[model samples]
Target chain A: MTDSSQVYVREVGPRDGLQHEQTWLDTADKLNWIEQLGEAGLTYIEITSFVSPSWIPALADADEVARTLKKSPGVTYAALVPNRKGLERALLANIDEVAIFLSASETHNQKNINADTESALARLSRVAEEARQSGKAVRGYLSMAFGCPYEGKVEVDEVERLAERLFEMGVTELSLGDTIGIAGPKQIEAVISRLGRMIPLERLALHPHNTYGTGLANIYAAFQLGIRRFDGSTGGIGGCPYARGASGNVATEDLVYLMQTLGAKTGNDLVRLTSSAQWIEKRLGRPLPSSQLQLSKEEGRCL
Target chain B: MTDSSQVYVREVGPRDGLQHEQTWLDTADKLNWIEQLGEAGLTYIEITSFVSPSWIPALADADEVARTLKKSPGVTYAALVPNRKGLERALLANIDEVAIFLSASETHNQKNINADTESALARLSRVAEEARQSGKAVRGYLSMAFGCPYEGKVEVDEVERLAERLFEMGVTELSLGDTIGIAGPKQIEAVISRLGRMIPLERLALHPHNTYGTGLANIYAAFQLGIRRFDGSTGGIGGCPYARGASGNVATEDLVYLMQTLGAKTGNDLVRLTSSAQWIEKRLGRPLPSSQLQLSKEEGRCL
Candidate 1:
């Protein structure tokens, strides 16, 4: 079900990354950074989340960001929408796609969105249907699919159940998130291979965090299993606000470098991708977690 | 030729990591840190390098460290010996093993050790023989085996040639180093698969840097190719001084995590290993590059 030769990297830095950051880039800086990411050949970018400002003040200007940013041809600008209100706001802003998320573990679901698994699914189902009816694609995110901080070692059957429900709700793709970054290659293989029996592999993407430094290896293991889509933050600058010790998502620059070295086409320019990371790092006023960015800063050149 | 059920983790932090560090720990701290490492279930540790004080002032107390560190029951204490003089010092210290290194690329060899490849190999040939004759195990490190800073992509043919020569010199095992941390899964697959045809895979190890963030993935690729031995630093603290932009080695805690997840026995307690990393991080007065260490510091517990 996967394209054996190509990888689709979805940039989540502007949404997932910024949401957890203490430093807030202004709407203008966010727009400019998103533009730089697109110019670096990232075709898919989750630009913002249409959640309540009180919940995530860092990305409070989601509507403004989505409506005002100039959309590039061949680039899909997505947004995370939590509920019907967020979806309405997203549709108003003409967002390209709407991503809805729930956790595989019940405790994590309640902790993350203040809803139990069943209610969260019911709510996301409505949101998914509404977004689809509005002629937009819906992407589902199953966080803590690997291991839950509250409930350790999420069962693969539970993951499959949630994933199937999302797919049944008319979602085109399901991104399995290692919310705490605890999954390794064995866990990736076990979960993805089990899930592959129930769904098309192409419809699945990996959203891995580098918390335990196994993100890339886990991604590689999934790629070997015919997974083609991956989620990465530009500077590896996002983690679950609820998952303690969860570090940044795998950096987009490092992901591109890994894909390129593995002989897969990601349509990303490494130098430009690294430069975009640098731009965001400078605005963040602290070093980002991406190894490529660190190397570039150290040597004053893209490796 | 390969052990499918076990992973040999060789700790190179004290030698390779401390050698590049800006802050030099006193000899007592180095000894204490190394003893802690051995107690944490690391069976092999390259404690320090017997290089000139002028070359690496940080590890100037190499002889003292090699002599003073309390050896654990199953631990093999090793040191990097540059030549006959270093080997003599190592022998006098009763080092359990002596590691000799040269670069696979001529320019890197010249820049790293101020000697050409052929001459460096010639010098190491004597060191390897002398170490073996002295009844200590001999380890050979081939730096820039993946990619070189000045030479870019290193030819696998050259790697094989150099590797065969080192094996001919009676070294027990050869560790191929990604000095710049630029190689990824494909390069690892290509180089290691080719070399496996010429030499026994069990006699080979991977010394990967996390510069480009593909260190664990590269190690995973090598492991899949029947490699069991890996070189890592406790806190991911070391890089090649000669290779610009080179970052830390793959963290020992992270490596153990990966290997354990892959169903291989590394005999390491992740908590103890991470605590050791934190211990070193404090003494260094800054964060080490290990993701596990960072996560532990953030969560106040080992992930």
Candidate 2:
């Protein structure tokens, strides 16, 4: 089992969460939110994505957001770069790390990036090389690692094959995405047990969605299997466009609460994290799906 | 670990869930819902409570609901009884089982039942005796077993003591409730490990809320510790009136989904359960907090 004392959480709310929102937040608001998340003790925050503005008008001002935000000391700011073009913009913005993503399922890869798996890997490899040449770290995201929407059940062998390819392309860490939120603890165990043989457990992170309310259970199972890193949104924002009716990423506040109760230190302040989530909830003009945020509001507690 | 092959789920939606709803459902609708639950493969359902109508107007027609609903063979119908008076009403209705409850925390007990732990236990012991004499099984619920809102951090020793007292009073089973939804996996492990020593694991159950999003994780932890019985509400209805900001009990649909995914047979039909939840959600004129229900609705699938 992994050491239960310390855990690393990467906040992907600003980028992944806001991308799916119909209401576009102002660039300044995004920067302020990112700064507040850092102040709340998040060591790593994915501020925005470098995809084409035409594709995601919500995060169109990513360059401005990355370049103008006040970067907190001791915090690593990252951004999602889809290709070499996105990587060049990330390099200009001096992002601390660049995240590239593809899908384990062939159908999902075709639908998500409009390219097959091999073609998408070829593009991400070029981006990884260029980002590394600029002395920046590269993180890979393997979507549908557990299940896919178009496809029924994704094979463990397919996930391992794609993960190994990403690692071979110099990707330092891979965050396995349960894009459809269809996984449970047993599925997590089955997949992680297979992957752990060929990949270092420490280099793996879990990105689970709470669509069917099994997100935290899956995380707990992975933790038991010695997986440490996790990714979550501040207010449980973000849903895959392809996965119909899917909830956002597992809420970061909820994840931190579980980790802390499990005796794992996440270096996050619960009160401040709740405050950040509430602040963003107001900005979004709609309630975010964080259970802790809802409870705090119901209790009328400042936290 | 408990036999991971089979699990017993007790549905508390009609009783605990409706008692907290602001809008009163018609007695006919309640009967219809209860029948549907049985048809959906729930073998144990808490149909109503025998408390005074003034205390819970939503369940004012408890006798009518209990007496008029069609009882399925092999399905046990239960109701919550506060004292000898309530048990008298329950016995008149010919309910199959009677459940009595108190709190692990002193303040919560006073606020919830208008009696301290000692007085509440004295009253419930009499209720249990009368119910058993009338040929009805008795189930005890210990609320705030994890933490209390009025008094934070309830002692596990206190839970053990109260549980032992109830078992001594001839309670065949005791369901430990996380009334405020403040527990995580570690707290579950801690509490169950202690309670398991003094009590038979099979006679213990977990009734968790989803307020802080740790409900399923807590259930998973308890299941790992050999807990086979769980209490849930269909569509995740019922929040604590005393515990401010607390969400409803863990959703039955979500629970069954988790158990099935973990290779445990719940004997509940997912499609029928989702339909029941959706039907109630419509009658309630609001969405229930079930993740699986939400996902099914989002997908626009019949299930």
Candidate 3:
């Protein structure tokens, strides 16, 4: 039987998904969504990114969004930071944690960050050192961990090396991201099974994309492999122009629905999640990518 | 390691999918789709039904469709028969096997066949007997086995009893049809595992709807329970018109993509599946529910 307690879902739509939206999220609106997510029992919400405004205009107000969040007692609010500069900005916002992301694929790394995979790793080491000195928790994200959109299939060893280097650099946890939504169940299990042997289960969180409609399947695969933490979007609103029509992330309501149905304790209120998902989908004036929210609405399944 | 070679994909789009279409497929169009499916290496294709044309005008030319099949050497062509009259029609047709469907829920059975579940099972008994005595293999279809659109969440005992009765009625195999798409992975596993203990692995097939977007997830859950056979439509069409659609059958292209990516041998070409799906979709003037087919076509995937 699958254990019910091991899955921990994190809503990353505000940081990962919203960062891709063309419309600028007002500071109050961003705070309202963050608070709503926290009240909906989302323990971890990636609040915003501390990246340069020129790179991600939607999140240019990351500091204000971070500062204005009505925090829950145990909720962890994480901020995405590219390097020491971004890290310094995030620390000033007094966020709960900071996440460092780098592309594992050489092509994506060069095109995305103007650095090869190794050079990105070297930068992460310096960032991790600064975070350690500041007494702040550093989390690492290995983008394109399962496969690369540009390069097709990725070597498992390449991902393992990146994970090992991040761990060696003193990052507390690693979130393996299928940036292009291409990881199927077998691939998710293959990567987790291989990585589980190298890193402790507690140190791994899975971030999957819904490009091939296997996002939840991949999450379940990781759950079966003893990984607990995962990442999702609220309405699945974020689309990466860079990823080229690829979906941003799995929908939060959909993820929670699958988990709750599978007997996993996410402590998430399905009704509020639906509202939050619907609220944002309305904000975007588009249909949400979440099957649960949409189906629940149709079936009148509200709390 | 899971032996991908053991998986058998049964293409049922022509019979199960097209039977309920509002826009009746032209005789030539059905033949062309079947031929393309055969050339794509699909070993089992449910060509058409021998049911009364008065009831289902969409499949009015079922007899001719069966007679004009390409007849690949090892391929299996099965026809659906609703009663003794339908079975008699199939017995005369040059078809290989006969299929009979019964609803697992009383309300669904009543709505579908104008009889309750018991009466439907009783009728299926005579249909199975007639097909058996004629030296043709009898396959039982247990519709609404998972969840009924009319009566929500069917009892497992109710389904098991019906399935057991059908098996005892000279029916060698059972295809569990989720009439509505409300069933999830856990529900699929719970029933499949309970039934698997009593029924042989090779004797089971799963039919799921994309209503809650659990079609692919249900496929994996069944796969975990050792079920290799599944029913799907080419573009994922047909639904309970009375129920106002809980989506329809899972898309054949999506199913093929899932099975192939999970290392299961379907022998069906993804490229060809997309082309055939697209061709019919254009003719129908409505989008087929095959996500991968749409994605692949938009991205210029070709055989």
Top-lDDT structure, candidate number? 2
Superposed by TM-score, candidate 1 places the C-alpha of residue B178 at a distance from the truth, in angstroms, of 0.8
Q: Write the per-residue lDDT of candidate 3 for residues A31-149, one digit (tens) a residue.
A: 98888999899888899999999988989898888887788998999989898899888888888888999777888899888888888888888988988888888888998888886
> How does residue B62 of candidate 3 score in lDDT?
86
Q: After superposition, how far is residue A51 of candidate 3 from its true place, in Å?
A: 2.1
For all the predictions, what are the DockQ values? 0.49, 0.48, 0.27
Candidates in order, TM-scores: namely 0.95, 0.95, 0.89
Off by over 4 Å in 2: A1-4, A240-246, A299-303, B1-3, B240-246, B299-303
- Tell me the spans in candidate 1 whose CA falls farther than 4 Å from its real position: A1-3, A240-246, A300-303, B1-3, B240-246, B299-303
For residue B193, give model 1's deviation from the true position in Å. 1.1
Q: Compared with the true structure, what per-residue lDDT tens digits does model 1 show for residues A1-303?
A: 446899999999999889877787999999999999999999999999999999999999999999999999999999999999999999999999999998999988777788899999899989998899999999989998999878888999999999999999999999999977889888999999999998999999999988888889999999999999999999788854433434579999989888988889999998998898889989988667787777775734322
lDDT of 3 by residue, B1-303 (tens): 556356777788888778767776888988898888888778888888887899888899988888877788878889898988877777777688988888888887777679977777778888888778889898888887887767787899988998889889978778998767767788889999899888987889998777666678788888877898888887776543332323467888878878876888887888888788888887777655566654654442110
Error of 3 at B2 (Å): 13
User: Candidate 1 — which pairs collide?
Assistant: none
Clashes of 3: 0
The C-alpha lDDT values of all candidates are 0.87, 0.88, 0.79
Reference-based lDDT, residue B55, model 3: 82
